[model samples]
Target: MITLAGKKALVLGIANNRSIAWAIAQAFHSAGAELAVNYLPDEKGRFEAKVRELTAPLAPAIFAPCDVRDDAQIAHLFETIASKWGRLDILVHCLAFGNKEDLQGPFTQIRRDGYSLAMEVSAFSLIALANRAVSLMPDGGSILTLTYIGSTRVMEGYGVMGPAKAALEANTRYLAAELGKQNVRVNAVSAGPIRTLAASGLGNIHEAIHKTEAASAIKRAVTQEEVANTALFLASDLASAITGQTIYVDCGFSIMGG
Candidate 1:
Protein backbone atom coordinates (compact mmCIF):
# COMPACT_ATOMS: atom_id res chain seq x y z
CA MET A 1 0.00 0.00 0.00
CA ILE A 2 1.22 3.48 -0.81
CA THR A 3 1.19 5.21 2.54
CA LEU A 4 1.92 8.88 3.29
CA ALA A 5 2.03 8.40 7.03
CA GLY A 6 3.39 11.45 8.82
CA LYS A 7 3.76 13.39 5.57
CA LYS A 8 2.44 16.92 5.58
CA ALA A 9 0.45 17.82 2.47
CA LEU A 10 -0.96 21.21 1.50
CA VAL A 11 -3.85 21.11 -1.00
CA LEU A 12 -4.98 24.32 -2.67
CA GLY A 13 -7.95 25.24 -4.94
CA ILE A 14 -10.76 23.53 -3.15
CA ALA A 15 -14.01 25.34 -3.94
CA ASN A 16 -16.51 22.76 -2.74
CA ASN A 17 -17.10 19.05 -2.18
CA ARG A 18 -16.96 18.58 -5.96
CA SER A 19 -13.53 20.12 -6.28
CA ILE A 20 -10.71 17.90 -7.48
CA ALA A 21 -8.55 19.38 -4.74
CA TRP A 22 -11.04 18.23 -2.14
CA ALA A 23 -10.82 14.71 -3.50
CA ILE A 24 -7.03 14.90 -3.40
CA ALA A 25 -7.19 16.05 0.19
CA GLN A 26 -9.44 13.13 1.07
CA ALA A 27 -7.13 10.69 -0.69
CA PHE A 28 -4.08 12.09 1.07
CA HIS A 29 -5.83 11.90 4.40
CA SER A 30 -6.79 8.28 3.78
CA ALA A 31 -3.15 7.55 3.00
CA GLY A 32 -2.21 8.82 6.45
CA ALA A 33 -0.78 12.19 5.41
CA GLU A 34 -1.35 15.24 7.58
CA LEU A 35 -3.33 17.78 5.55
CA ALA A 36 -3.48 21.55 5.15
CA VAL A 37 -6.11 23.10 2.85
CA ASN A 38 -6.62 26.58 1.44
CA TYR A 39 -9.63 28.62 0.34
CA LEU A 40 -9.82 31.87 -1.58
CA PRO A 41 -10.62 34.88 0.56
CA ASP A 42 -13.84 36.80 0.04
CA GLU A 43 -15.23 39.96 1.66
CA LYS A 44 -18.01 38.01 3.38
CA GLY A 45 -15.83 35.08 4.50
CA ARG A 46 -18.31 32.80 2.75
CA PHE A 47 -15.56 30.85 1.02
CA GLU A 48 -13.75 30.25 4.30
CA ALA A 49 -16.91 29.17 6.06
CA LYS A 50 -17.96 26.79 3.27
CA VAL A 51 -14.53 25.20 3.06
CA ARG A 52 -14.28 24.87 6.81
CA GLU A 53 -17.64 23.10 6.95
CA LEU A 54 -16.89 20.87 3.96
CA THR A 55 -13.50 19.79 5.31
CA ALA A 56 -14.64 19.27 8.86
CA PRO A 57 -15.05 15.54 8.31
CA LEU A 58 -11.41 15.21 7.27
CA ALA A 59 -10.21 17.41 10.11
CA PRO A 60 -7.41 19.14 8.20
CA ALA A 61 -4.66 20.27 10.55
CA ILE A 62 -4.34 23.67 8.90
CA PHE A 63 -7.11 25.53 7.08
CA ALA A 64 -6.30 28.99 5.84
CA PRO A 65 -7.03 31.57 3.13
CA CYS A 66 -4.61 31.96 0.26
CA ASP A 67 -5.14 34.02 -2.82
CA VAL A 68 -2.34 33.01 -5.15
CA ARG A 69 -2.58 36.40 -6.84
CA ASP A 70 -1.62 38.10 -3.58
CA ASP A 71 2.06 37.74 -2.72
CA ALA A 72 1.35 38.73 0.86
CA GLN A 73 -1.27 36.00 1.24
CA ILE A 74 1.05 33.49 -0.39
CA ALA A 75 3.79 34.43 2.04
CA HIS A 76 1.42 34.23 4.96
CA LEU A 77 0.27 30.78 3.83
CA PHE A 78 3.81 29.45 3.68
CA GLU A 79 4.56 31.16 6.98
CA THR A 80 1.64 29.36 8.56
CA ILE A 81 2.89 26.06 7.19
CA ALA A 82 6.34 26.77 8.51
CA SER A 83 5.02 27.64 11.96
CA LYS A 84 2.62 24.72 12.12
CA TRP A 85 4.35 21.86 10.34
CA GLY A 86 7.90 23.17 9.91
CA ARG A 87 8.18 21.23 6.65
CA LEU A 88 5.89 20.18 3.79
CA ASP A 89 6.00 16.87 1.96
CA ILE A 90 3.45 17.43 -0.76
CA LEU A 91 1.92 20.46 -2.45
CA VAL A 92 -1.20 19.84 -4.56
CA HIS A 93 -2.14 22.71 -6.88
CA CYS A 94 -5.57 22.30 -8.47
CA LEU A 95 -6.28 25.93 -9.23
CA ALA A 96 -7.32 27.28 -12.63
CA PHE A 97 -9.58 30.05 -13.89
CA GLY A 98 -10.57 31.89 -17.06
CA ASN A 99 -13.07 34.63 -17.64
CA LYS A 100 -16.43 33.47 -19.05
CA GLU A 101 -15.93 35.52 -22.19
CA ASP A 102 -12.45 34.12 -22.71
CA LEU A 103 -13.58 30.54 -22.15
CA GLN A 104 -15.93 30.56 -25.14
CA GLY A 105 -16.34 32.22 -28.56
CA PRO A 106 -13.46 32.62 -30.97
CA PHE A 107 -9.99 32.53 -29.47
CA THR A 108 -9.05 35.64 -31.48
CA GLN A 109 -11.78 37.53 -29.67
CA ILE A 110 -10.22 36.87 -26.27
CA ARG A 111 -9.56 40.10 -24.39
CA ARG A 112 -5.98 40.93 -23.42
CA ASP A 113 -6.86 41.33 -19.77
CA GLY A 114 -8.85 38.13 -19.73
CA TYR A 115 -6.00 36.29 -21.41
CA SER A 116 -3.57 37.76 -18.90
CA LEU A 117 -5.83 36.82 -16.02
CA ALA A 118 -6.11 33.26 -17.29
CA MET A 119 -2.38 32.89 -17.59
CA GLU A 120 -1.67 34.47 -14.25
CA VAL A 121 -4.21 32.49 -12.30
CA SER A 122 -3.93 29.15 -14.09
CA ALA A 123 -0.28 29.02 -15.06
CA PHE A 124 1.82 31.60 -13.26
CA SER A 125 0.30 30.73 -9.91
CA LEU A 126 2.09 27.37 -10.07
CA ILE A 127 5.44 29.08 -10.38
CA ALA A 128 4.61 31.46 -7.56
CA LEU A 129 3.37 28.67 -5.30
CA ALA A 130 6.33 26.48 -6.15
CA ASN A 131 8.71 29.27 -5.23
CA ARG A 132 7.26 29.43 -1.73
CA ALA A 133 6.58 25.70 -1.43
CA VAL A 134 10.21 24.80 -2.14
CA SER A 135 11.29 26.83 0.86
CA LEU A 136 9.17 24.70 3.16
CA MET A 137 10.31 21.54 1.45
CA PRO A 138 13.87 21.57 2.76
CA ASP A 139 13.59 17.84 2.45
CA GLY A 140 12.61 16.22 -0.86
CA GLY A 141 8.90 16.49 -1.69
CA SER A 142 6.31 16.27 -4.43
CA ILE A 143 4.63 19.25 -6.14
CA LEU A 144 1.67 18.38 -8.35
CA THR A 145 -0.65 20.50 -10.48
CA LEU A 146 -3.76 19.74 -12.55
CA THR A 147 -3.84 20.25 -16.30
CA TYR A 148 -5.97 19.05 -19.24
CA ILE A 149 -5.77 17.67 -22.79
CA GLY A 150 -6.93 21.07 -24.07
CA SER A 151 -3.43 22.31 -23.27
CA THR A 152 -2.10 20.20 -26.13
CA ARG A 153 -4.95 19.84 -28.58
CA VAL A 154 -7.56 22.28 -29.74
CA MET A 155 -10.75 21.85 -27.75
CA GLU A 156 -13.69 24.07 -28.55
CA GLY A 157 -14.84 26.21 -25.60
CA TYR A 158 -11.62 25.56 -23.72
CA GLY A 159 -10.32 28.92 -25.07
CA VAL A 160 -7.67 30.83 -23.11
CA MET A 161 -7.44 28.03 -20.57
CA GLY A 162 -5.83 25.92 -23.32
CA PRO A 163 -2.81 28.12 -23.51
CA ALA A 164 -2.80 28.56 -19.77
CA LYS A 165 -2.72 24.82 -19.24
CA ALA A 166 0.01 24.53 -21.87
CA ALA A 167 2.06 27.01 -19.91
CA LEU A 168 1.33 25.10 -16.73
CA GLU A 169 2.64 21.87 -18.27
CA ALA A 170 5.75 23.67 -19.49
CA ASN A 171 6.27 25.14 -16.05
CA THR A 172 5.96 21.67 -14.55
CA ARG A 173 8.85 20.39 -16.63
CA TYR A 174 11.04 23.40 -16.01
CA LEU A 175 10.34 23.33 -12.28
CA ALA A 176 11.11 19.63 -12.16
CA ALA A 177 14.46 20.18 -13.86
CA GLU A 178 15.48 23.07 -11.64
CA LEU A 179 14.28 21.48 -8.42
CA GLY A 180 15.58 17.98 -9.10
CA LYS A 181 18.81 18.84 -7.36
CA GLN A 182 16.82 19.62 -4.28
CA ASN A 183 14.99 16.29 -4.71
CA VAL A 184 11.70 18.03 -5.37
CA ARG A 185 9.40 16.37 -7.90
CA VAL A 186 7.11 18.44 -10.10
CA ASN A 187 4.40 16.98 -12.32
CA ALA A 188 0.90 17.60 -13.72
CA VAL A 189 -2.16 15.41 -13.79
CA SER A 190 -4.30 15.68 -16.91
CA ALA A 191 -7.78 14.56 -15.98
CA GLY A 192 -10.86 13.82 -18.08
CA PRO A 193 -13.86 16.14 -18.11
CA ILE A 194 -15.97 16.28 -14.97
CA ARG A 195 -18.96 18.44 -14.04
CA THR A 196 -17.19 20.53 -11.44
CA LEU A 197 -18.29 24.09 -10.73
CA ALA A 198 -15.24 25.45 -12.52
CA ALA A 199 -15.81 23.28 -15.57
CA SER A 200 -19.43 24.44 -15.79
CA GLY A 201 -18.15 27.69 -17.24
CA LEU A 202 -16.94 25.92 -20.36
CA GLY A 203 -19.30 25.92 -23.34
CA ASN A 204 -18.69 22.36 -24.48
CA ILE A 205 -18.15 20.61 -21.19
CA HIS A 206 -21.16 18.32 -21.60
CA GLU A 207 -20.15 17.47 -25.14
CA ALA A 208 -16.59 16.86 -24.03
CA ILE A 209 -17.68 14.50 -21.29
CA HIS A 210 -20.06 12.61 -23.53
CA LYS A 211 -17.48 12.27 -26.28
CA THR A 212 -14.90 11.09 -23.76
CA GLU A 213 -17.27 8.42 -22.56
CA ALA A 214 -18.22 7.32 -26.06
CA ALA A 215 -14.76 7.25 -27.65
CA SER A 216 -12.15 6.87 -24.93
CA ALA A 217 -10.69 3.44 -24.34
CA ILE A 218 -12.43 3.08 -21.01
CA LYS A 219 -15.69 4.34 -22.49
CA ARG A 220 -16.40 6.52 -19.45
CA ALA A 221 -15.37 9.76 -17.90
CA VAL A 222 -12.81 9.57 -15.10
CA THR A 223 -14.05 10.33 -11.62
CA GLN A 224 -12.57 12.87 -9.23
CA GLU A 225 -11.59 10.01 -6.94
CA GLU A 226 -9.75 8.28 -9.78
CA VAL A 227 -7.79 11.43 -10.46
CA ALA A 228 -7.18 11.82 -6.75
CA ASN A 229 -5.75 8.31 -6.57
CA THR A 230 -3.22 9.24 -9.22
CA ALA A 231 -2.37 12.26 -7.10
CA LEU A 232 -1.96 10.04 -4.08
CA PHE A 233 0.52 7.87 -5.96
CA LEU A 234 2.42 10.88 -7.19
CA ALA A 235 2.51 12.40 -3.73
CA SER A 236 3.80 9.24 -2.11
CA ASP A 237 7.23 7.61 -2.43
CA LEU A 238 5.70 5.30 -5.06
CA ALA A 239 6.37 8.00 -7.61
CA SER A 240 9.72 9.04 -6.11
CA ALA A 241 11.38 8.74 -9.52
CA ILE A 242 8.45 10.16 -11.46
CA THR A 243 8.66 13.86 -12.17
CA GLY A 244 8.40 16.41 -14.97
CA GLN A 245 5.65 14.37 -16.64
CA THR A 246 1.94 14.81 -17.24
CA ILE A 247 0.12 11.70 -16.21
CA TYR A 248 -3.24 11.46 -17.95
CA VAL A 249 -6.20 10.23 -15.96
CA ASP A 250 -8.52 10.78 -18.90
CA CYS A 251 -9.73 7.29 -19.69
CA GLY A 252 -7.32 7.35 -22.65
CA PHE A 253 -9.24 10.17 -24.31
CA SER A 254 -6.07 11.93 -25.39
CA ILE A 255 -4.91 8.91 -27.34
CA MET A 256 -7.72 8.63 -29.90
CA GLY A 257 -7.13 10.05 -33.36
CA GLY A 258 -9.51 12.64 -34.69
Candidate 2:
Protein backbone atom coordinates (compact mmCIF):
# COMPACT_ATOMS: atom_id res chain seq x y z
CA MET A 1 0.00 0.00 0.00
CA ILE A 2 1.29 3.45 -0.91
CA THR A 3 1.04 5.68 2.12
CA LEU A 4 2.13 9.27 2.65
CA ALA A 5 3.84 8.44 5.92
CA GLY A 6 6.13 11.20 7.22
CA LYS A 7 4.85 13.59 4.54
CA LYS A 8 3.38 17.02 5.30
CA ALA A 9 0.39 18.33 3.38
CA LEU A 10 -1.43 21.66 3.45
CA VAL A 11 -5.09 21.37 2.44
CA LEU A 12 -6.76 24.72 1.76
CA GLY A 13 -10.44 25.75 1.51
CA ILE A 14 -12.07 23.43 4.00
CA ALA A 15 -15.27 25.20 5.11
CA ASN A 16 -16.70 22.13 6.84
CA ASN A 17 -16.66 18.35 6.93
CA ARG A 18 -18.91 18.12 3.85
CA SER A 19 -16.42 20.00 1.73
CA ILE A 20 -14.39 18.07 -0.87
CA ALA A 21 -11.25 19.53 0.70
CA TRP A 22 -12.18 17.96 4.03
CA ALA A 23 -12.69 14.60 2.35
CA ILE A 24 -9.24 14.79 0.78
CA ALA A 25 -7.79 15.85 4.13
CA GLN A 26 -9.39 12.85 5.80
CA ALA A 27 -8.01 10.49 3.17
CA PHE A 28 -4.55 12.02 3.44
CA HIS A 29 -4.69 11.75 7.22
CA SER A 30 -5.59 8.06 6.99
CA ALA A 31 -2.61 7.58 4.71
CA GLY A 32 -0.37 9.04 7.47
CA ALA A 33 0.31 12.58 6.27
CA GLU A 34 0.70 15.30 8.87
CA LEU A 35 -1.99 17.84 7.97
CA ALA A 36 -2.16 21.64 7.93
CA VAL A 37 -5.49 23.21 7.04
CA ASN A 38 -6.44 26.73 5.90
CA TYR A 39 -9.84 28.36 6.04
CA LEU A 40 -11.27 31.85 5.69
CA PRO A 41 -11.12 34.01 8.84
CA ASP A 42 -14.86 34.21 9.36
CA GLU A 43 -15.13 30.42 9.02
CA LYS A 44 -11.99 29.43 10.91
CA GLY A 45 -13.71 28.46 14.16
CA ARG A 46 -16.25 26.29 12.40
CA PHE A 47 -13.56 24.60 10.37
CA GLU A 48 -11.44 24.01 13.46
CA ALA A 49 -14.44 22.76 15.44
CA LYS A 50 -15.37 20.23 12.78
CA VAL A 51 -11.79 19.19 12.25
CA ARG A 52 -11.68 18.55 15.97
CA GLU A 53 -14.84 16.40 15.79
CA LEU A 54 -13.44 14.57 12.76
CA THR A 55 -9.72 14.32 13.55
CA ALA A 56 -9.95 13.96 17.32
CA PRO A 57 -10.14 10.19 16.95
CA LEU A 58 -6.95 10.40 14.91
CA ALA A 59 -4.29 13.05 15.77
CA PRO A 60 -3.84 16.73 16.45
CA ALA A 61 -3.52 19.17 13.52
CA ILE A 62 -3.06 22.87 12.77
CA PHE A 63 -5.73 25.05 11.18
CA ALA A 64 -4.69 28.47 9.93
CA PRO A 65 -6.72 31.47 8.82
CA CYS A 66 -6.03 32.10 5.16
CA ASP A 67 -7.99 34.19 2.72
CA VAL A 68 -6.07 32.97 -0.32
CA ARG A 69 -6.91 36.07 -2.32
CA ASP A 70 -4.48 38.07 -0.21
CA ASP A 71 -0.81 37.95 -1.13
CA ALA A 72 0.26 38.75 2.44
CA GLN A 73 -1.70 35.82 3.84
CA ILE A 74 -0.32 33.48 1.18
CA ALA A 75 3.24 34.57 1.88
CA HIS A 76 2.69 34.17 5.60
CA LEU A 77 1.22 30.71 5.01
CA PHE A 78 4.36 29.38 3.33
CA GLU A 79 6.45 31.13 5.96
CA THR A 80 4.48 29.43 8.70
CA ILE A 81 4.84 26.08 6.95
CA ALA A 82 8.57 26.58 6.68
CA SER A 83 8.84 27.54 10.35
CA LYS A 84 6.71 24.63 11.57
CA TRP A 85 7.45 21.76 9.19
CA GLY A 86 10.60 22.92 7.41
CA ARG A 87 9.24 21.72 4.02
CA LEU A 88 5.97 20.69 2.44
CA ASP A 89 5.39 17.49 0.51
CA ILE A 90 1.95 18.28 -0.85
CA LEU A 91 -0.42 21.22 -1.29
CA VAL A 92 -4.07 20.69 -2.18
CA HIS A 93 -5.97 23.80 -3.29
CA CYS A 94 -9.75 23.32 -3.30
CA LEU A 95 -10.83 26.95 -3.19
CA ALA A 96 -13.43 28.40 -5.57
CA PHE A 97 -16.06 31.15 -5.55
CA GLY A 98 -18.73 32.65 -7.83
CA ASN A 99 -21.65 34.99 -7.38
CA LYS A 100 -24.99 33.23 -7.08
CA GLU A 101 -26.64 35.86 -9.25
CA ASP A 102 -24.31 35.13 -12.15
CA LEU A 103 -24.79 31.42 -11.72
CA GLN A 104 -28.57 31.71 -11.82
CA GLY A 105 -28.52 33.50 -15.19
CA PRO A 106 -27.14 33.05 -18.68
CA PHE A 107 -23.38 33.35 -19.27
CA THR A 108 -23.89 36.48 -21.37
CA GLN A 109 -25.72 38.12 -18.46
CA ILE A 110 -22.88 37.75 -15.97
CA ARG A 111 -21.86 41.02 -14.26
CA ARG A 112 -18.29 42.20 -14.74
CA ASP A 113 -17.43 41.96 -11.03
CA GLY A 114 -18.90 38.48 -10.80
CA TYR A 115 -16.91 37.34 -13.81
CA SER A 116 -13.62 38.82 -12.64
CA LEU A 117 -14.07 37.60 -9.07
CA ALA A 118 -14.89 34.10 -10.26
CA MET A 119 -11.76 33.83 -12.38
CA GLU A 120 -9.53 35.53 -9.82
CA VAL A 121 -10.56 33.51 -6.80
CA SER A 122 -11.30 30.23 -8.54
CA ALA A 123 -8.62 30.09 -11.23
CA PHE A 124 -5.73 32.50 -10.60
CA SER A 125 -5.61 31.71 -6.90
CA LEU A 126 -4.36 28.22 -7.71
CA ILE A 127 -1.44 29.68 -9.61
CA ALA A 128 -0.70 32.09 -6.76
CA LEU A 129 -0.74 29.32 -4.17
CA ALA A 130 1.42 27.04 -6.30
CA ASN A 131 4.04 29.69 -6.96
CA ARG A 132 4.47 30.27 -3.23
CA ALA A 133 4.25 26.59 -2.29
CA VAL A 134 6.94 25.59 -4.77
CA SER A 135 9.44 27.73 -2.86
CA LEU A 136 8.72 25.84 0.39
CA MET A 137 9.00 22.44 -1.28
CA PRO A 138 12.75 22.24 -1.76
CA ASP A 139 12.65 18.46 -2.26
CA GLY A 140 9.97 18.26 -4.94
CA GLY A 141 6.27 17.77 -4.16
CA SER A 142 2.77 17.61 -5.53
CA ILE A 143 0.15 20.32 -6.07
CA LEU A 144 -3.42 19.24 -6.76
CA THR A 145 -6.56 21.31 -7.41
CA LEU A 146 -10.26 20.68 -7.85
CA THR A 147 -12.12 21.18 -11.15
CA TYR A 148 -15.47 20.15 -12.64
CA ILE A 149 -16.73 18.64 -15.94
CA GLY A 150 -18.54 21.91 -16.67
CA SER A 151 -15.14 23.19 -17.76
CA THR A 152 -15.37 21.34 -21.07
CA ARG A 153 -19.09 20.88 -21.65
CA VAL A 154 -22.04 23.23 -21.47
CA MET A 155 -24.24 22.70 -18.44
CA GLU A 156 -27.16 25.01 -17.79
CA GLY A 157 -26.76 27.34 -14.81
CA TYR A 158 -23.07 26.57 -14.64
CA GLY A 159 -22.61 29.95 -16.37
CA VAL A 160 -19.33 31.64 -15.45
CA MET A 161 -18.27 28.66 -13.39
CA GLY A 162 -17.70 26.72 -16.60
CA PRO A 163 -15.30 29.30 -17.98
CA ALA A 164 -13.55 29.61 -14.61
CA LYS A 165 -13.04 25.85 -14.56
CA ALA A 166 -11.75 25.96 -18.13
CA ALA A 167 -9.19 28.57 -17.11
CA LEU A 168 -8.22 26.47 -14.10
CA GLU A 169 -7.68 23.43 -16.34
CA ALA A 170 -5.51 25.44 -18.72
CA ASN A 171 -3.53 26.87 -15.80
CA THR A 172 -2.93 23.37 -14.48
CA ARG A 173 -1.32 22.28 -17.75
CA TYR A 174 0.87 25.35 -17.91
CA LEU A 175 1.96 25.10 -14.28
CA ALA A 176 2.67 21.40 -14.72
CA ALA A 177 4.95 22.13 -17.67
CA GLU A 178 6.72 24.98 -15.92
CA LEU A 179 7.17 23.22 -12.59
CA GLY A 180 7.97 19.77 -13.93
CA LYS A 181 11.62 20.75 -14.12
CA GLN A 182 11.51 21.50 -10.40
CA ASN A 183 9.86 18.14 -9.70
CA VAL A 184 6.75 19.92 -8.44
CA ARG A 185 3.98 18.05 -10.25
CA VAL A 186 0.74 19.96 -10.82
CA ASN A 187 -2.61 18.41 -11.75
CA ALA A 188 -6.35 18.98 -11.44
CA VAL A 189 -9.15 16.62 -10.47
CA SER A 190 -12.33 17.22 -12.51
CA ALA A 191 -14.84 15.77 -10.12
CA GLY A 192 -18.50 15.02 -10.71
CA PRO A 193 -21.26 17.03 -9.09
CA ILE A 194 -21.22 16.39 -5.38
CA ARG A 195 -23.78 18.07 -3.16
CA THR A 196 -21.88 20.69 -1.16
CA LEU A 197 -22.69 24.16 0.10
CA ALA A 198 -20.97 25.68 -2.90
CA ALA A 199 -22.84 23.43 -5.34
CA SER A 200 -26.08 24.94 -4.04
CA GLY A 201 -25.05 28.18 -5.74
CA LEU A 202 -25.58 26.53 -9.11
CA GLY A 203 -29.26 26.97 -9.91
CA ASN A 204 -29.77 23.42 -11.21
CA ILE A 205 -27.17 21.22 -9.53
CA HIS A 206 -29.70 18.59 -8.53
CA GLU A 207 -31.00 18.39 -12.08
CA ALA A 208 -27.45 18.10 -13.35
CA ILE A 209 -26.88 15.20 -10.98
CA HIS A 210 -29.95 13.40 -12.21
CA LYS A 211 -29.03 13.95 -15.84
CA THR A 212 -25.48 12.71 -15.20
CA GLU A 213 -26.76 9.58 -13.49
CA ALA A 214 -29.01 8.85 -16.45
CA ALA A 215 -26.18 9.23 -18.94
CA SER A 216 -23.06 8.05 -17.12
CA ALA A 217 -21.77 4.51 -17.46
CA ILE A 218 -22.20 4.08 -13.73
CA LYS A 219 -25.69 5.49 -13.92
CA ARG A 220 -25.13 7.21 -10.59
CA ALA A 221 -23.84 10.50 -9.28
CA VAL A 222 -20.28 10.43 -7.95
CA THR A 223 -19.45 10.93 -4.29
CA GLN A 224 -16.99 13.13 -2.42
CA GLU A 225 -15.15 10.01 -1.31
CA GLU A 226 -14.48 9.02 -4.90
CA VAL A 227 -13.01 12.44 -5.67
CA ALA A 228 -10.99 12.42 -2.45
CA ASN A 229 -9.52 9.01 -3.20
CA THR A 230 -8.36 10.15 -6.63
CA ALA A 231 -6.81 13.23 -5.06
CA LEU A 232 -4.93 11.00 -2.62
CA PHE A 233 -3.44 9.00 -5.47
CA LEU A 234 -2.31 12.13 -7.29
CA ALA A 235 -0.78 13.64 -4.13
CA SER A 236 1.06 10.47 -3.25
CA ASP A 237 4.34 9.16 -4.61
CA LEU A 238 2.32 6.51 -6.47
CA ALA A 239 1.58 9.11 -9.12
CA SER A 240 5.18 10.30 -9.41
CA ALA A 241 5.26 10.17 -13.20
CA ILE A 242 1.87 11.81 -13.78
CA THR A 243 1.51 15.58 -14.18
CA GLY A 244 -0.15 18.35 -16.22
CA GLN A 245 -3.30 16.21 -16.55
CA THR A 246 -6.96 16.49 -15.63
CA ILE A 247 -8.21 13.30 -13.98
CA TYR A 248 -12.01 13.12 -14.16
CA VAL A 249 -13.77 11.26 -11.38
CA ASP A 250 -17.14 11.86 -12.99
CA CYS A 251 -18.59 8.32 -13.04
CA GLY A 252 -18.02 8.29 -16.80
CA PHE A 253 -20.42 11.20 -17.15
CA SER A 254 -18.10 13.15 -19.43
CA ILE A 255 -18.04 10.24 -21.85
CA MET A 256 -21.80 10.45 -22.34
CA GLY A 257 -23.00 11.86 -25.68
CA GLY A 258 -26.38 13.40 -26.44
lDDT of each: 0.94, 0.87
Clashes of 1: 0
TM-score list, all predictions: 0.99, 0.95
Residues 1-258, model 2: lDDT tens digits: 659999999998876667898888889989999998876765447755665566565463566668877899888888888888888999998989999887778778899999999999999999999988988888899999999988988888888889999999999999999999999999999988888988988968888899888999899999999899999999998999999999989999888788
Clashes of each: 0, 0
Best by TM-score: 1
Per-residue lDDT tens digits of candidate 1, residues 1-258? 889999999999989989899899999989999999999999999999999999999899999899998999999999999999899999999999999989887899999999999999999999999999998888899999999999999988999999999999999999999999999999999999998999999977899899999989989999999999999999989899999999999999888877
Q: Using lDDT as the measure, which candidate wins?
A: 1
lDDT of candidate 2 at residue 207, scale 0 to 100: 89
